[model samples]
Target: MIKKITIFLLLVALAAAAGYGYVTKQVEQYIAQPLNIEQEQIFTLKSGTGFNRVLSQLTEKGIIVGSDFSKLVRRFHPELTQLKAGTYLLEPNTTLAQTLELLKSGKEHQFAITFVEGSTFKEWRQALETAEYLEHEMSGLSEAEIAQKLGLEHDKLEGLMLAETYHYTFGTSDLDILKRASSKLQAILDEQWQQRQEDLPLKTPYEALILASIIEKETAVEEERERVASVFVNRLNKRMRLQTDPTVIYGMGDKYDGNIRKKDLRTPTPYNTYTIFGLPPTPIAMPGEASIAAALNPEASNYLYFVASGKGGHVFSKSLAEHNRAVRAYLKQLRSNQ
Candidate 1:
């Protein structure tokens, strides 16, 4: 009789084990199955949002099916009360397991914005302010305040950031982007300074940066960067004024219309290269790597002047007469076009 009772207990245990195995298999299949989503979509998990809310949202959106999903999740991860919050791009046919793992990973979708090489600091700020995803922290802060936050010794804020497209997740601050760009600029400036050509007229890396900003504004042509750098470098070496029109317009600030008149050049400001005998007190625009490198390592040329070639380039010359001739041709072309 005892043996029969033992046999009955063994049968009960076997039945229980089989049932558990079947349930485990079902749960595994359920997790491995793809969701009912037909197309790609973006889902946001806001900060402090719980996992239950996330699950409810997903289910309501028809991204997930089956009423047992929540129960299965609870069975599998009862302790998982919350998901890391951020924007997520959900692809079609993504499995439940994949989605869960993605949420758990916490890496959000990254967005990109490019700061053009010759763009002003104000333009850069505008770009950040208008960007869709970036958090705008500097909207109310003055340039001086921003400079202080960046730990820049100079009160002025122009030309401090590096021009590059930076990728960041949503909830990222504009100041955060600026800080990264600033750090990048400092590193590049230091590295390029170490490799600068000998006898460069630049007194320091900051001087090189000022020259680089001018070079960046001077030409968009890649081949002309060194030539443009040479003109300014030679001018500096010979104590000739840079006489670049961009600086004149920059100095005019809000008063500058589309055209730069003779008076604007004659009107003196700290930034007007036409009036100033040396580099501007501060850079006028952000410079790129090529321009910065050209500033540090100028072409070995005695050419001291450049005029627009009327074909989207410049005509470099060693004498004022040649520059004058090029300027006359540019003016004539401008008149003919008009």
Candidate 2:
């Protein structure tokens, strides 16, 4: 009786081991399947969030098929401890293994550091100081040195970098960042220059950029960019000076103290269009993509000038006489409203 009981117990133990192995294989197979679909989704995990909380959130969001499966896999693999907290965009059909790999590698998502249209060099300098990718502070880089490093003929890079988000790899150099941005801007300029409207007064691509920079400063509204571009285009066609206040501000540089006095316009500098008959020697601020496009393809209008309408946009005119009248009306309106 004892021998029979011993044999029976041994058989039961073998059967239990076989069942466990089979169940473990099935669980592994289930966890390895792709969790993502065709659509892209953004997931953010805050610091100090527990693994179970993350799993629950993913499960709720339908990214994970089963919370239990994810939990099991995570428990089995303790090496995935390098996951950093940040926003992640999971592309379609990403496998669980791939996601696990991403977390394990601790690759933080890359984001663009945007330099908005019409931002001055001072603003650009501050932005660079804040961004994590730049090793040297903005103060360390002079315009001439940065230009030399980026292969630019002009010393100023503020208005030339082109406002856009650029993807950066880990450990990207400042020179490389400048190179990529400048290259994109160059391409846009070339394309626009080639397809430029007939009889346009733009002498060169640099001249076009200068005009674009002015247009960028003139308006923030998308609809108004073309109209604003038309005003400058008309002025250029008629050989009139682009007496933009921003140009005077650029020329004033450090002396501009939050106020544009009557004397500031008289102060002659390279960027002062009032002093210079043509476009400035360089751009005053970085132009966005739309501004560049608008500069190249200005609206066909008789508008030769514009002034702030005090409505967050510009009021355009076909001639100086009309422009002066509009300016008077707008300024009066502005004073009354204030």
Candidate 3:
């Protein structure tokens, strides 16, 4: 009877071992199973979400199956329980193990927003308002108010932010983006200013920014920026009025209707370079690093004038007579095109 009892106990232990081995194999297969998705999709995991809840949701959405095994597998891998909350981009054919690895790794999907060179602060603000998944906090605020929030001593916010593609995660605020861009711009400006060429007419980095904004608006040609900067710098050294049309448009503000009349050029405003003897009080638009660099270190040239070539780029001139001829040529071309 004792011998019979010992044999029964051995049989029971063998059965238990087999069952345990089968369960372990099933859990491993479940972990290796691919998610049920054919294309890429965004998955937002909110704060304070638990692992079990995430698994259940995935199961309900048919993104994954066999949550029971996943829960059972989690008992051995305690690290899987520590899931981070953020927006995730789940790709097709990703296995359950990889998905769990991503969730626990805390590497969330990044979104991008671009601020183009020569765009005004108003345009940047509008872009921020339209950006997806970004928290808007600067809506309906005046430029001065927004500047104050960014800790800017100057009331004007123009040209303070850098023009570049900024990457951010979910729940990033508009103010935070502005702050980062502003900080980046300041750092670049400081670095450039420290390495600037000697004897530049610009008294401060702000003056360089002002001139850079003009250079940005003057030409879109990559090669023409330094030459354009030279013209402005020469004009500044000679105390010649800038007489640029963009400044007139900026000064006219809402009054400008795409055409710059002779009367508009003669009208005196703080931003009207034709009337103002010095640099404008603020930058007219955002300037990229290239323009900023051009402002600080201009090409050596005696050219003082430029006009649109009416084909592409501009015809630079060293004298007013040459500039007038170029202007007439541009008009003739314009008339021919019409």
Candidate closest to the true structure, highest TM-score? 3
State every prediction's TM-score relative to the real structure: 0.83, 0.70, 0.89
lDDT over C-alpha atoms for residue 97 of model 1: 76
Which structure among the candidates has the greatest lDDT? 3
Residue-by-residue lDDT tens digits, candidate 2, 183-282: 9888888888898887777888888888888888878899998888888888777788888898998888888898998877877888888878888888
* lDDT at position 52, candidate 2: 62
Cα lDDT of model 3 by residue, 1-338, tens digit: 99999999999999999988888888888878899999987788889988878888888888988645777867766766788999998999899889989999999999999999999998998899999899999988898999999999889988998999999999999999999999999999999999898999999999989999999999999999999999999999999998888888888888988899999888899999999887999999999999999999999999999999998899999999999999999999999999
Error of 1 at 16 (Å): 11
Note each model's CA RMSD in angstroms. 3.9, 7.6, 2.5
Output the worst ten-in-a-row residue range by lDDT, candidate 1: 73-82
Q: How would you encode candidate 1's per-residue C-alpha lDDT over 1-338 as one tens digit per residue?
A: 99999999999999999987877777677667787877877788888877767777888887876555465665766544446888887888789778877888887888899999989988998888899777888988999999998898878877888998999987888999999999999999999999999988888899988999999998999999998999998889889999998898788888987998888888999999888799999888999999999999889898988888788888888898987998899999889889
TM-score ranking of the models: 3, 1, 2
Clashes of 2: 0
Assess candidate 1 and give its TM-score to the true structure.
0.83
lDDT of each: 0.86, 0.76, 0.91
